[model samples]
Target chain A: MENFLQFNSVSYFYQTKDNEIQAVKDLTFSVNENQFASIVGPSGCGKTTILSLTAGLLTPSTGEILIGNEKVGKHDGKVGYMFQRDHLFEWRTIWQNITLGLEIQKKNKDPKKLARAEELLKKYDLYNFRNKKPRQLSGGMRQRVALIRTLMLEPQLLLLDEPFSALDFQTRLLVCDDVYDIIKREQKTALLVSHDISEALSMSDRIIVLSSRPACTKQVVDLSFEGKTPLLKREDKEFGRYFETIWRSLTNENQKTS
Target chain B: MAGILKPFGEVLPMKTKKQVNFSQAHKKYIKRLKQEKILVVFLQIFILALLLGLWELLAHFEVIDPFFFSSPSRVIKCIASLIAGGEIWMHMGISLAETVIGFIVATLLGAIIAILLWWSERARKVSQPYLVILNSLPKIALGPMIIFWVGSGFSATVVMCVLICIVITIISLLNAFTSCDQDKILLMQSMHASKFQILRKLILPNAIPEFVSVLKINVGMSWVGTVMGEYISSSAGLGYLINYGKSMLNLDLVMASIILLSILAGGMYFLVNLFEKRKQQ
Candidate 1:
């Protein structure tokens, strides 16, 4: 399959005032067009560093990354990032937050973009809260707003960095399903970096497991389940088997590091 | 044990009754809260009245010299006479204009300078110590020099007001702008937002609470600067009136001017507070 994004022997090192910390070691992976892929690993295992490199927020020390056959630059406007926190401006209402990117890009006056924002809010059941501040919404609702805000930009790839970790388990499940449904319905490719094995397994078409510091892909697991949505897929009879397999891979790497 | 249990027994029945008629009880609770609020306002007025009454009585009995310490009634009469003559309005109007102008200009200039400092780390580092030194210097000491530079007129008074207010506004706002959540800025950066866009969309909005706080502080500072400026050189204004009354030994006029100053400052503070409440909502 033709890759939408490719990491060609990408290695990254963060330089502090005193020492250079090797973050990623010759990492190589790719996500195909319109595919939902996840990078899962142990906590503080350079998952976010990989996302940062992919987003072109940081340059790789030794390798190159390509998006749609083009090299990623410092500010490409091609990658949309959803942080762990919603980071919605409290002063802005839902409508304002949704159009933050377009406003930054000065595309807010575009009628087509405005209509898309309105349609997304309406379709996602957040139309009623469009005029309300982000603090007024529940956790799940805020994440949905965050997703819609990202979607308004219509970037080729969505980079989510543990977007659901702040939520309670119950809300996390529901939001996972909602986000998965939205990504699928919009036909957008996504790269999620998460520590939750189940989250990665249920929401992703493929999972890229990374080792500890100086992370490189340890294993790539492709998952298929009879159920369509993430919540439904969580109940698949083989869900536990897949979970065991990913868990073993992560723990085996942890053991090697120790 | 029975004596303590008796009070508990009585409360239990009432609590159960309230639970049985929850809506009615809730309404009664709200009504009681409203009555309590009204009572508190009444008590505040009563305290003020009692204090004024005591001051009048003391002055009338010659316990305190009425000449040096004017009574509340005398102050009111003095204000009433000024109002009747229509002289108080000019002083009040000139002072109000100076204050409003100074407050707005200082706030805008200070916020812009703060944004500049936030944008350039080198500029901030270079100017920070100078700002600290300026903020610490007694601004009143600069009164004669400012009057000399700007001339002894309305502009001098406004210059004094701005001088007093601007440094603090810049410092506080810079602190707020620099301390905006780094993650949020990174999120904006990821979207290819320029520094100016981040300022408009993130930093400025994030600094609003601090901005409002600075406005509240500036309200008081601007008044002080204007009045101080008037003390140095002003042909008309409440500050000028106070200086005139003091020189002429008209304690009542001085008291009246001070009262008017407090009322105007209180009004400005109340407006800033209203802005804060609306922002919160």
Candidate 2:
């Protein structure tokens, strides 16, 4: 498989009034085309920074990030980001919110793109809620709406920054399955940043575990399950073994930091 | 459990056997709500009538000296005569024009300045302290200087209203623009949106509710500014009438001017509130 997104020794430093803080250091990883990859790390372990760097919102202080063998630059159109919060403009109805990117891109007049938006809404069982405001939707529905909004842009890569963390436990599990299904069905490459081991293990084709702040790759675990869906994969015989491996890797990093 | 199919294809839950009893209870709930509303209005009107009667009686008996206090009937008589003479119209019209013009100009100019500040980080940083100082300084103290600069006329009055309203507008609007969700902005950036696109699509829409609230605040601030300006230096206006009446010891005219001012201010507030409600809907 061809690597769709690559980070070559990427490092990021945040400059404050008093001192400089290194958030990411020598972080090297890659997500192949049509792959669901996740980067799991301890809290505040620069997981979000990695997503930001990949999305070209911030420049790597050292090393390079590439999408399809090209260097990532500011406001890369090939990348779509799904934030932890749905970030749906409450004032806008679901359909209007979904087309916000198209409006910004000046592609709102395109019939094809608008149809895709309509199709995604219907595909995700949100057709009935097309005219409702985001606040009127449940937590899981809002997350689905957020994903649909991102997918509307038709980017080559999707960057999800702890997209399920804001939801309740039950909603989180359901949304995780929903998102995994959507990403797989769309045949789009995805890089998820998460701290939940089960979440990453269930959805990701490969999981890259990171050390605490000044984040660097600690281990990269490739996953294979006979079950097709994330929920079904959660019940796989090897699920516990993968969980223990990722858990111990994370806990070891925590002990090292302390 | 099945539901009835409506003409519009909506599913209406079937009325259950036990639920039939709720119809009477619902009617009683609605009746109680209506009675409560009517009772509230009646009590409010009764309270106002009682207060006015007491005030009129007190003044007639010379218990509170009507010369200074001025009874409601005297105020009404003064208004009636002024209406007959038709001089109050000119004063009311001039004050209304100054206040409306000032309110509009201040809000637009302040919002524009806020946009400029939000667009540039350095501009916001440079103007932060100056804005704080200008916002805190007593604007009334600048009344004489404004008159000196713009002359003691309509221009000065309008300038006073703008001065009082603009700083608060700038501060509030700038805060609203800056405090917009950073992640939403990032989402826009991920779509490769330009700075102007982000502002137009996200920042401007996000700040609208705040702008409406600012307009509501300006309704009162504009009145204060216009009145203060007239007090400082004005040959015409409701404020001028009140000031002239004070100097002449015509308490009836002063009280009448105040009453007119209150009515106009209340009307303006009501219009703005109505506009806000429509926008919310």
Candidate 3:
């Protein structure tokens, strides 16, 4: 019930030499601790902008964004982001990629952190691949590796921006399950940005829908289902109703904008 | 006729060895062979045969002295003599030392400078244009000036090689570091990585392929700079041997020196290629 992250009337604009294009306007939201939250809406609805703002890479034009009761800027390390592309360095062995944060933080000497990294690789069945490069892995495996790389940092909240959009449908389903299990097992909270209504409905505790460009939060739904995993939940008889409701919310908003 | 069967069982490209149909496999082999060689092979064989035929023709006509033109056979004999006397090895050793030292120093200096420049956006903005301007200037024009400053010594030759090669290394690697997937950098930032941490873990590691490529380009450039420096001033080196051969009108010596230079360049090229292959693996 308590807020773990808050966006207080946040707005963003990109200023070029000629003009300023507003990306998001007066956006306000809060995510509770340990909640799996997702944002879904039309293309270019500032979904990615929201993630960037939350990560403190882009300063909000009008209002403040907070993480763990502190303004985002005051603490830069409390968030973890996974992108649309896994963006794993091709030259690094999988083990090296996962431990990159620790090495960079000079935490390689910390026995506990190093052990946790190894344990995660073993648990994920990527242990055998620890010596392989990112290119050597399949697309789904690379995404899992990317996720593990973020988890190694052990941040308070993980941000995924359409993380499985590039994957084939079959791989996407399996990866969605793998990702959810990892988040739960690690006891880490997450905020995912996706376009898949079914993905948002199935994987998230709450879905935040935004309006089109210069986006603002349009609706929020708290989802509950009678199944354990995303694939199982997709088979739930009520899945159609939930999908329809979210679909109408997105489509109706687009109609209003046009 | 194949249309009905087209969608059924296409093998993955990786499975090319085991699963094959004649038309597709034959076409693929043809495409690959065409890609691997065309102009380079033709030019190589043409150059070889033309030189030999020209030498034999000139000797037959006696239009110019064989001593000055130095028929291909005479050049080969001179090469054999140089190798037999061990003079070629000594001269080659001196040039190789200059080239290797200069190359290593240039690469390190360039990498350090690139890292420092990359760390500060303001520094990159200010210095990048000047570097471009410096690289644009012909390095050979500065050969004599370098000889004066370093007094036509070994260190001056090394400095010349470094001067020629450092710009390329810095430009290539700095580009590589900057071009690291922005998403990945953002990921690192969210993990609360420090600037130094990102450099050590993400940026530098990602830049390895590019850095290796830079070494490949610099191998030849540094050799050129070192040999040019030696030719302009040094008392010993393969370049000096060539310059002496030219003054004495000994065409066989000149040809021998050039063959020796090619071997040195080819050796360095092979070493760099090996490094690249290992990285790829």
Best-matching candidate per TM-score: 2
Q: lDDT of candidate 1 vs native?
A: 0.91
Instruction: For each candidate, give its TM-score against the true structure.
Output: 0.89, 0.94, 0.84
Model 2: residue B30 alpha-carbon error in angstroms: 3.8
By TM-score rank, best first, the candidates go: 2, 1, 3
lDDT of 1 by residue, B1-281 (tens): 23322311222111212345468878999999999999999999999999999999999998999999999989999999999999899999999999999999999999999999999999999998899999999999999898889899699999999999999999999999999888899889987899988988889989999999999999999999999999999999999999999999999999999999999999999999999999888
Interface RMSD of 3: 8.2
Model 1 residue B276 lDDT?
98
Q: lDDT for every model?
A: 0.91, 0.91, 0.85
Count clashes in each candidate, considering only residues at least 3 apart in sequence or on different chains: 0, 0, 0
Candidate 1, DockQ to 2 decimals? 0.24
* Tens digits of per-residue lDDT for model 2, B175-211: 9999999898888888888999989989999999999
TM-score of chain B of each: 0.89, 0.90, 0.82
Which lDDT tens digits does candidate 2 get at residues A153-246?
9889999999988987867877788899999999999999888889989999999999999999999999999878888899999999999999
lDDT of 2: 0.91
> Which residue pairs overlap in candidate 3's backbone?
none
lDDT at residue B1 of model 1 (Cα atoms): 24
Write down the DockQ of candidate 2.
0.39
Clashing pairs in 1: none
